[model samples]
Target: MKNKTLLTVLSIIGMGLLLGWFILQMKPPHVNEKSTPSANQQAQTKTNSPEEKYIALTPEAQQKAGIRVKVAGPVQIKTVLELPGEIQFNENRVAHVVPRVEGVITAAYKHLGAPVEKGELIAVLESRELADLKSQYYTAIKRRELAQITFDREARLWREKVSAEQDYLAAKTALAEANIVVTAAAQRLLALGLTQDALDTIPQESQSKLSRYPIRAPFDGRVVRKHVVRGEAVKADAELFMIADLSTVWGTITVYTEDLNQVHLGQKVTVRSEELGLEATGTISYLGYLIDAQTRSTQAHVDIPNPEERWRPGLFVTVEVAEKKIPVPVAVAAEAIQTYRNQPVVFVQHGNGFEVRPITLGRRSGNGQWIEMVNGLSAGERYAADNSFVLKSELGEAMAPQ
Candidate 1:
């Protein structure tokens, strides 16, 4: 019975050894730690393998891929074209009020910004020259009266043959020459702005003769500039007042040479002012023949109505000139554009990756949202529509010196 029990225990131990050997060899033949897992290898009852190298995932890249993409599309560029400039006055309508004769400015009746009408008295001038002319006129008038009385007597004598014809002719010549003298003196007084009524009053009020000259406003306008004061000597034809008709002022549109073609005479223009929040409608009145040397721009002038006197001569304002529109080729979105050092590139998607391409830009469309391309990008072409700037940075880092 002991020999039979020992035989049974040895038999059980032998079975256990056989089972362990089979389990060890059951792994696929030639299968090793270095081998890549095949489709059939994963089907094994128990197996462990390292991941494939090409398909290996970095933590950073995995996190990036898991994040939601920012959705973007083409936004057309248009409007809000801010052309800079200042306001100006109408050159044709503006006028300067100056004194006609040299004199001392005795009065400053008009304020610097006061409104005045045509022929309204502005100031008075005390002039010695004017007084001298008046004196000459008074002397000539008295001499002319005496000559007339003498001529009447000579005519009566000639008609009765009581005197010789030569005697009468001599008197006639003397009277004629005296009249010419009177005429010359009268012209001097007229040149000095002596009115007919003033001349008549001069002889009766000879003792009241004075040296004052009245200056009148030449036109209906507001006094924008003043160059005279009481007791100040004013020169002849010197600009004492810069009077301007603010009823209408200039709204100048300074368009570049490239945009000059878009404007024409009589084109409707709208002008707005910030000071008074006033809007004035005007028409293109003049187109400048020459371009500004500094700005390289041409001025197109519009005549704006300013009945409320809100828009003054020098207030800065804006002019909106509608330009002609034209269609152009544009790459739908800004995301397609990438920069490579000094050049612009577009990442055109190819297969599963992308390739950078250089492109030329044209006029801005969607005002600035989408830029028009002169060359390179095309419609309906698949491209890296987002994160193009990221690709640009990568290209820069790659091209850096080692």
Candidate 2:
């Protein structure tokens, strides 16, 4: 009984030993301590080695891409007040030509868009009314001539004592009355736009020409409107032609009540037409005292020299009034800015290439040609100024999934 109990104990011990050996074989081998890393160490390694993105190009390639580089530095930023406006004729230089006398249009010498010099004949009129006025002037002159001859005879009779004093005085009074009538007739013709030279020639002019009257231009300008045609009967006050001296034009700006305080006469203004690609600079010359009731706005005009006449009247334009000027430490050309990953960025010059740098923007210039860099850029750093889109396109292609 003792031997059997001992055997059972031995068998139990042997089974325990076999199970321990099996566990040892299945376990992994131990590694060197120097080859293994801790959790913190692994995380730190990942953090330190981040993927950097950039574009690589040569100087020749950049030039071929039409990329222009400029140094970032202090820039004069303009605070602009923008307003809507339209090009209009300078009212001071415009004229509404009218005939002073009622007449029929014998000829229309000037047409729309025709240029004329001062005192140039623009039209002719034939009127019996003008003829009657000329006849009265000539009749008065003939009566004055007869009176002068009688006055000479009467003066001689008075001086020589050969005639009665009452007769001589009567003849002298008649002559004086006739001279007054002649003076009145001459004044009447002078008031009808007839020059002194014209009056002197009227008596020598043919009777048919006595009815002819010429309408002349008041100044050097272009005919903008023609209201009369050949054979058309026009009234005395009718506007026959509209002439405008287009050497200068007016850019009429509508100033809202909110912008009134910022606008004033003599302020520098720039007028721009995006569609026509036209631009001009001038100073504010006029401001309206009364505000428009419906628009709740006042008008201001800038007199711009339009020697080329490119600034046509009635063209809608944008007026930018320079309110103030500010100097910024860092600024870049507006065209240099680009959108990347929904963020505003600029291409900064790197060694042999450029790197995309995100930036914070501040105020823009009044001309919209420059932008202030609040951050992510430094003054004196070279950057892409013109055609920066080329760099952006290259970056996009390089980062795109293959």
Candidate 3:
């Protein structure tokens, strides 16, 4: 009985030991609680140990790469009011040439876009009206000559008492009437576009040339429009040609109701055309008092010097009017800012190299040359100003697959 009891006890102990061994085999391998981290702890560690990006460029390399550096500090940020505009001819310098008398265009000396000097002949007209006026003037001159001879004879007779006094008085009256007629005719020709010198030559000119009327340019300019052709008849007050002096141009800007208060005469303006890659500085020359009812906008003009004639009329441009200037604590060149990982970053001068720092941008200058920094930058920080893209390119290559 005792042997059976001991065997039972040993079998019970063996079963207990086998159950414990199976549980141990099913459980995972031993791991130290102190050494292993939880999910939150792992995430925290990863958040703390962020990969830093930098560009390793020497001063010599930077110079060779055309990378310029500048120190950040307080800068004046211009608040600009940008408006769309169009180039136009300066109205004060433009002219519409017209023929003062009705006539046929016998000759057209200038074509469209032809340059003309002041008093240069542009066309000639043959008009019967002009011939009639000349005829009247010459007829009066002949009568005056006859009257003068008669008056001289009458005066001598009156002094010698060889002629009756009544006869002498009648001859003198005829001479005075002739002189008045001649003076009146000359004044009429002067009013008909004839210079005093031209009138003097009328007596020497042939009858065939009496009807010839020359049209002259009033000022130095280019012919922008021509309405009459050779052999074409034109009327008085007809627009013969349009001339414009293109040395200066007008940049006409539309100032909305909201912007009218900000724009004023004598304000400095910058005109830019992206399509032509042209830029010019000017001042507001005119501001309209009336607002257009349809567009709800007022017109303003900037007089831009266009000596090269590059700023042609009808070109669309941007007019930037400087408003108030605000001083910002930090600012950098617009070229210094770049995009990295979908964030705005600037390459700051770090120890022996440049470090990519994210930034919060604020306002930008009216000229787009500088930008204000709201965060991630401070005064006195050295940064890449011009050609900062070189550093960005270098950073990209370094981060690329090796």
Cα RMSD to the true fold for all candidates: 13.6, 4.5, 3.9
How far is 243's C-alpha from truth in model 3 (Å)? 1.9
lDDT of 2 by residue, 1-402 (tens): 999999999999999999999998896878877598888888767544312246889999999988999999999898898899999999999999988788999999888999999999999998788899999989888888898898889889889999888888888898899989978888888887889899888779898999998989989989999999999998879999999999999999899999999998888788999989999998899999998999999999999999989999999999988888999999999999998888899988988988888899999998788899999999999999999999888888887789
Candidate 1 regions with alpha-carbon error over 4 angstroms: 1-85, 167-179, 192-197, 274-276, 292-294, 323-402
Task: Give lDDT per model, in order.
Answer: 0.69, 0.90, 0.90
Mind giving the per-residue lDDT tens digits that candidate 3 earns over 1-402? 999999999999999999999998896778898698989898777544312476778889989988888999999888898999999999999998887778999999999999999999999998888899889999998999999999899889999999889888998999999989988999888877789899888889998999999989888889999999999888878999999999899999999999988998899889999999999999999999999999999999999999888999999999998889999999999989999888899989986688888899999998788899999999999999889998888888777788
Q: How many collisions per candidate?
A: 7, 0, 0
Q: List the residue pairs that clash in candidate 3.
A: none
Best by TM-score: 3
By TM-score, the better pick of 2 and 3 is 3
Considering summed lDDT, which 10 consecutive residues are worst modelled in model 3? 45-54
- Overall local distance difference test of candidate 3: 0.90
Q: Which window of ten consecutive residues has the lowest lDDT sum in model 2?
A: 45-54
Local accuracy of candidate 1 as per-residue lDDT tens digits, 1-402:
999999999999999999999999795777575477667766552322111101222436434644112222333445333334455767776777766678888798998889989879998887887777777777888887887887788889999998888878887887888889878887776765556776777777644345777777767888888988898998878888888888887776778888777678998766777676877768988888998899899877788887887776666777766564555545446655656656776766544444566678766652345666777766656655555565555555554589
